[model samples]
Target chain A: MTARRTWATARRVLAQLRNDPRTIALILVLPTALMTLLAWILPDSEWQKYAPPLLGIFPMLVMFLVTSVATLRERTSGTLERLLSMPMGKGDFVFGYAIAFGVLAIVQALVVAGVCFALLDLTVRGSAPLVVLIAVVDGLVGTALGLFVSAFAQTEFQAVQFMPVALLPQFLLCGLILPTEELPTVLGWISWLLPLTYAVNAMQHVVVDTQLDTRFWVDAGVITGMAVALLALGAVTLRRQTR
Target chain B: MTTAAISVRDLTIVRGPVTAVDHLSLEVPSGQVIGLLGPSGSGKSSLMRAIVGVQVMESGSIDVLGQPAGSPTLRAQVGYVTQDPSVYSDLSVLANLRYFARILGVTDDSVERVLDQVDLREVADRLVGRLSGGQRSRVSLGTALLGSPQLLVLDEPTVGLDPALRRDLWTLFHQLATAGTTVFVSSHVMEEASRCDRLLLLRDGRLLAEGTQSQLLERTGCQDIERAFLAIVEGGAS
Candidate 1:
């Protein structure tokens, strides 16, 4: 809970991200560039109509990739262990890492939002602050998932083994590619339990809402609650690993 | 004698159904170099891990630096360099030093001074992963010595070093001992075994002997520490 230690951890992580070119590219360039490319290629009829849902998927994809890659790299290189040995507590480390990744997620979210406006000629139906809030919630959830995966992973190869567990289930059940109404009853219930499902729905409410929706706030609350739960789980898992 | 730097009472560590380190009550005094001597799988490394809070003890109390081990203050005061070189391989020697320096909150340029002390300032720009085994060991030593810790715990530090460097490293250890740093080095090296101020001989998760080199030899009527170790292990059978 110490802000000073959290800031130190965040600075160290920022320095590493700056030094790593591939990570920098992934953080600053990929999301917006992909958004622009998709905006340009898709015509006005079919693809442009699905821009909101597709755009919602972009942040989760970015979050999953960045956090998974970053945590795995840190664990494999022993930096995670080194951090654990420092004066910082487990909660602070998780919060600091999540804060930094949240910054990156904000950047990526903005780029996607910017591309939607500039390239696709689409206006956001909701306020920009709501969009930023969604990014923050997504970032926290993603950081927790990444740290949880890193706890069980001994190496980068083993960390990659969590891709199916971390990413694939959300894509399949989170109503990304298909509608939740079309999914099976049990599978649809599982999708509702996913953090990303709540995040995506919240983003959709932000970017495509015709009027104020109470369900969007509920979705945002669900996402935030999931983030808190995942963070607690991550902290316990990390404590076990360090011991 | 002053209070023991390390005081463990009935220390036992069980990894699942297997007891890695059994009921091992012992005291390691301040300003003395104690060697935890044992072969692989003999609970030597497990003892080191339990000392620093990395491994959990099933039932026991470990008092380090006059407080319970794994306390925030005790952990910050003690320096533990694991058996494996835990330095960042991608980071240069200077970068590695700076990272630890920042972590320890040492304000001055202590990294260069530590590297100089270890005679590694010349290769400060080289990546740690690219360095030879002995050089990496020096870096690990530098890290443990960074804060001038009262209790320096090193696990198998000289495993890959050559004879001459190993001798020099032991000399450095003795120098630290004279400077009042309580050095605890775990190793299976018999020759280096003689350099410790005291020895904690362990086998199969139990303490076989704990005393000075001369005391152990006289008690067992053995020629050297190695012979004394064999006699103790063999004598335990009867």
Candidate 2:
């Protein structure tokens, strides 16, 4: 993809988002609010225990909703088709969106992670900056998946509906409710295949391990690989015209 | 067909159970406004889509600017404005133009040129969502007009504009053609048909008649485009 086109798409998306305050709030505020509510629900120590992994998943869920809905709007509104006809590559459009949402996702990551550490009394054995970094990467993964999933949805309602279908399995099997090994053999296998599992697996090690360990490296590698692969898939699958 | 701005040879497009464009063959000459007129479902849009290299044809071939339809080279050379307002309403008119200008790899000056051309200079900074329906269409027109493409395909561009705006756009079409840009426009308005250098009349995804306005009237023994179209369609039916 050409830098000019990708940067143009990103700038245009940001300008559109700037005009839309409600979507901004949804992307930047919703995660912090949910995490805060969860902070209030459990004891501080117990909350810190769950917060790292939940931080990984929270941005994923929120960015997925925002990115998918926004991308689906481009599809249903006819802009995507119009832009495709111009002197542009599908990667330019998709990656431009990824860069735009990825920027906002970084903002969301910082805000949410800051809330977790300062307000929620989250203290861990490892690097909090590393936790924030993983959270940002989680946002990128969400952005890629959202861009990918939007192709399957025809309307905003359908796009929103995909969140559950696409993410519910990730939540259920990502060692959030149960450790992966404690699950059934088939489900445990499925969890290993999911990026959320690896993401959660990596982030949780932050609270338990004092240093960057080999297991954490493996999980981090898997999640990062998933992000890159999904971004490529999204670019390839984006239709330049109605099929 | 080889030298024309666009050439379609035995092209057929099937959408669901119906053939949107049925074995249609036509040569759109260079540097002129060729108006395509048809009934609502007569494949006016489907044909425009094909010219823009976005539609999937069931058979035959379409060559644009001496290249196969949908070729990478044509992306910058051909500009397409569909029936819908294919622009971001949340952004201002200026923002929309600027973004398209960058995407088309044109200089920043085109945004100002299009703003003036579309007569939205005063509202350039206003969000497109807040503009009138007529003005929104002009924004889409401005998007296509960026990069100064060799072939411009606009579908029903004047559907919502006033007579004054219509006249101005027709003037602009001729001006672009004079500068060696081939403009392919589609419209249902019969009055606008007379403004075209050539016209292609379609019915049921088939070419009913085509020629200059005077030629069509003389051939059908009718005084106006509407009657000429009716006469051609009715005579061919029997």
Candidate 3:
């Protein structure tokens, strides 16, 4: 893939997002707001116990929603087909989207982490920077998964429908709602198949373990590997024309 | 002798159980405005998509600009406009063109030139969503015009345009042809047939005739291209 073409695609995507104020607010504000709301509503002891894992999950959910709908919009509007007819390789389009959303994920992670640390006065035993890293990776995984899912959806409504089918199960089983260790063996085995489990596991380690140890590295590696695999799958599944 | 801009031999495309383009063979000479005239569902758009390398064919082969159709090398030399206007509605007209220009490796200034070519300079900064349908189609056309591609495949670009706008677009097509760009335009409207330097009349996925407006009329002893087309269809049936 040509770097210049990929960069151009990324820039164009960002430019389009700039014009969409609602989406901008959703991308930058929604996760932070949800985190703040949760922090305020929960008791101090429970907040301390739950905040870090919630932070990991929030970025994934928001990025998945935004990227899937946005990419699906391009498909439904026929713009993706038009772009494909150009000299652009499938990698350029997919990577361009990944880079663009990756940048947004960085901003999203930073905003949520900053608010969690500075405003909410949340304490992480592990390195705070590690929390941000896990969050960013979580967002990237969301982006990759969204791109992959958009290929199967014909309309934005159908894309939104994927949240319940593809993402909600991860939320339930990834130790966000119930701890994986506490889950039934069959349910826990299913959690191993999800990328978000590793993201949540890594972030939870940063919150409780106070150090980047073997567990953290393994979880981070799995998350990164899943992101790459999903991105590649997205590239392969992308159609030149909607049939 | 100059090579045909596009050459197809027994091109057949089937979608599900139905044949969309049936063993079609034709040659489009360079630097000419060739119109693909057919009724709706006559495989006009499918034929255009195959030439641009986007549609899969059941059989047959297409050669565009001396290369195999849909070759990566031909990507820069060929431009295609789909039947629907495909510009991003959220983007300004200039931004849409600039995006495509960059993808095509054309200079940034090419965006302005294409906008000017399509008479969209006045609304360059307007969001495509705010533009009229005809205006949006012009923006889509302008995107295809970027880099002055050698072969432009336009599918039903003038469907909803006013008569004057349609005439203006045909003039632009002729201007591009005069500058040595081969234009392959598709339309189901019979009236558009006469505007083309060469015409390929299609029915139910097969070609009925391929010739100039006058040649078609003379061959069928009809005064107008539409009647000429009807005559040929009737004669074939009889």
Candidate 4:
């Protein structure tokens, strides 16, 4: 948990990503592209109504895909083992990854939110910074969850498989398609257990409510708490040896 | 007595049903190049991993640099290069070295120093993915060389390297030893055993012999290390 080592680990991850253009596009460009497409295909009124929730969803989805596969690659390539053999602690690696991906998540959220407000003419009742804040928090949740999930996967292919199994259900149950309260009791309870539900609820609150409210703070707190918990779990579960 | 660079006492490691390392005990002195010579599955890599504090052991103890093996204090003191090239393929050789140098808490100049030592200065800017397998291995080795670590545990570093490169690497190993770095390198090639200052012959997760080339040869009544190794293996079997 040395701060200098953790920062070094984070800088190393960023340097690796800097050398890779495709990953850069995936991290920084894909969210903006997807948001623009949503604006273009849907009618103006529909786009305005749907953009807020989708904004929360896009960063989470993209960050999850990127973080899981990247971390899995680190495992398969023996880079993680090499790092572990050095003085770096498992916490350093996990937190380093969280911080690195957290930065990328902020960049991603800003790009997506900027496009939604500036280019698409989408408006929200609350502060624009709040929208960006919720999006960034959603991205952090995705990053933490991805790190936690990568421990269960032995290969990059299996990491990709986890997305549909682990994340798709959360997407379906997070009130994007239908309101949670409108669903069956069991299903609504399940949605309540998911971090994505809190993320979506907070973003929706920021978009529709003019003033900060208790519900908004509670939702944001839950999302942040989930991220921290998952990151701690990831650090605990990380295996240093490939065999 | 001079302090041993590494001391393992009755170390045992099990992977699944197989006992990969069985009650192995040895001492590696400082400022020497020792080779752990064994076949592919003889637990050479596993033993090396244990010495570097990465492998889980069933029993016994390993002390490195006056600390328990794998202690936080030993992190910068030990450098390890795995069988597989562990550098970031996307980054150039210099970039990979720089990253590891930072992790080792060394200045960036250490990167250039290691690159020069491994004779990779000309290709410092080349991406590791684009380098040949041997060159990529040198980059991995270069990463371990940062901070002039007290002990270097390299697992099968020359497995796929050309004879010329292998010779060059052995020369570098001796040079590092001359500069007071203890090197514990693993190799399956019998001919390479003669190049080491001392040898630990392993078979089926146990040590067959531990001594200089002539000592092993004389003890086994064989003319060369290769025949001596075969004789020892045969005698152990019977």
For this target, which candidate reaches the highest DockQ against the unseen true structure?
Answer: 2
**lDDT rank, highest first?**
3, 2, 4, 1
Model 4: how far residue B20 lies from native, Å: 1.4
How high a TM-score does candidate 2 get?
A: 0.96
lDDT of 1 by residue, B1-238 (tens): 6679999899988876778888888899999888999877788877887777667778898898888877777656788787777776666787778767767777446887798878998899887878998898788778867877889888898898898898888888888889998999999876667889889888888888888888988999988888888998888831
RMSD of 4: 2.3
Per-residue alpha-carbon lDDT of model 4 for B15-121, expressed as tens digits?
77899999988888889999999888999988888888778888999999878887878888998999999889988888788878877789988887887889999
- Maximum-TM-score candidate: 2
The global C-alpha lDDT for each of the candidates, from Candidate 1 onward, is 0.76, 0.88, 0.88, 0.88
Residue A175, model 1: lDDT of 75
Worst 10 residues of 1 chain B by lDDT: B99-108
Candidate 3 lDDT, B24-109, residue by residue in tens: 89899999999999899999888898888878788999999998888888888998998889989999999899889889999988
TM-score of each: 0.85, 0.96, 0.94, 0.93
Interface Cα RMSD in Å, per prediction: 2.9, 1.2, 1.8, 2.0
Runs of candidate 4 exceeding 4 Å displacement = A40-45, A151-161, A240-243, B1-3
Q: Is the docking of candidate 4 incorrect, acceptable, medium or high quality?
A: medium
**Per-prediction DockQ scores?**
0.32, 0.73, 0.61, 0.57
Model 1 misplaced regions, further than 4 Å: A26-44, A72-82, A110-137, A149-163, A181-189, A210-225, A240-243, B125-127, B218-224
Instruction: Name the weakest run of 10 consecutive residues (lDDT summed) in model 3 chain A.
Output: A234-243
DockQ of 2: 0.73
lDDT of 2 by residue, B58-90 (tens): 898998999998888899999899898999999
TM-score pick, better of 1 and 2: 2
